[model samples]
Target: MKIMTCPFNGPRPVSEFFYWGEIRPMPDPATCSDESWADYIFNRNGAPGVKQEWWCHIASNTWFIAERNTEKDLVLRTYLFEEEL
Candidate 1:
């Protein structure tokens, strides 16, 4: 079974966690056009590569960021939203 190390909860089975989605920057809603806002909400870069994504630990209700390599299906590291590793 795959193991994911939660930033706060340590190592645990991957099954205990949920993948949210890739972290992307949101355009400033005040200055951005409608088309830009729509595109930001609906589109994602689906290319296979290293990406930082949001993940949640179900039991503990912990939220964190996971940097993973999609091509190899590997998680490089996990950290809280305010941290990097």
Candidate 2:
């Protein structure tokens, strides 16, 4: 029953959003070894904390970032890709 604000569409039901994985920097593939590249593609930091992640409004297919706390399942804020740090 949680409501999430979409940067383009304003407030919407949480059900309308898809939880994409955490936003992390991709290693430089040109210089990265096979193991490192594989790690980058397969590994995830499972630590609990406020994390910036990608979420899409499925109905609109619009993508945005949400700063959410894992422990409480609380979303601190949501913004467009360009609006983030």
Candidate 3:
């Protein structure tokens, strides 16, 4: 079975977690055009590569960020949002 390490709860079953999506920077609303905001909301990177994503531990109601590789399906690290970006 797959396992994911939760920052608060330690390692747990992967099934206990929920994957949100990749972390992307939002375009500056003040300076960005309509097309830029549209692209930011609609487009997603589907390519296989390392990316930081949002994850939640359902049982504990804990939300965190996970750095994972899509190609290899490996989690490099996990941390809370308040932690270093």
CA RMSD of each candidate after superposition: 1.6, 1.2, 1.2
Q: What is the lDDT of residue 28 in candidate 1?
A: 100
The whole-model C-alpha lDDT of candidate 2 against the native structure comes to 0.93
Rank by TM-score (best first): 1, 3, 2
lDDT of 3 by residue, 1-85 (tens): 9999999999999999999999999999899999999999999999999999999999999999999999999999999999975
For all candidates, the clash counts are 0, 0, 0
Candidate No. with top lDDT: 3
List where candidate 1 sits over 4 angstroms from the true fold.
none
TM-score, cand. 2 vs. native: 0.91
TM-scores of the candidates are 0.92, 0.91, 0.91
lDDT of each: 0.95, 0.93, 0.96
Give the number of the best model, judged by TM-score.
1
| 61: Cα error in model 3, Å | 1.2
lDDT of 3 at 85: 56
Q: For candidate 2, write residues 1-85 as lDDT tens digits.
A: 8998899999999999999989999999999999999999999999999999999999999999999998899989999998755
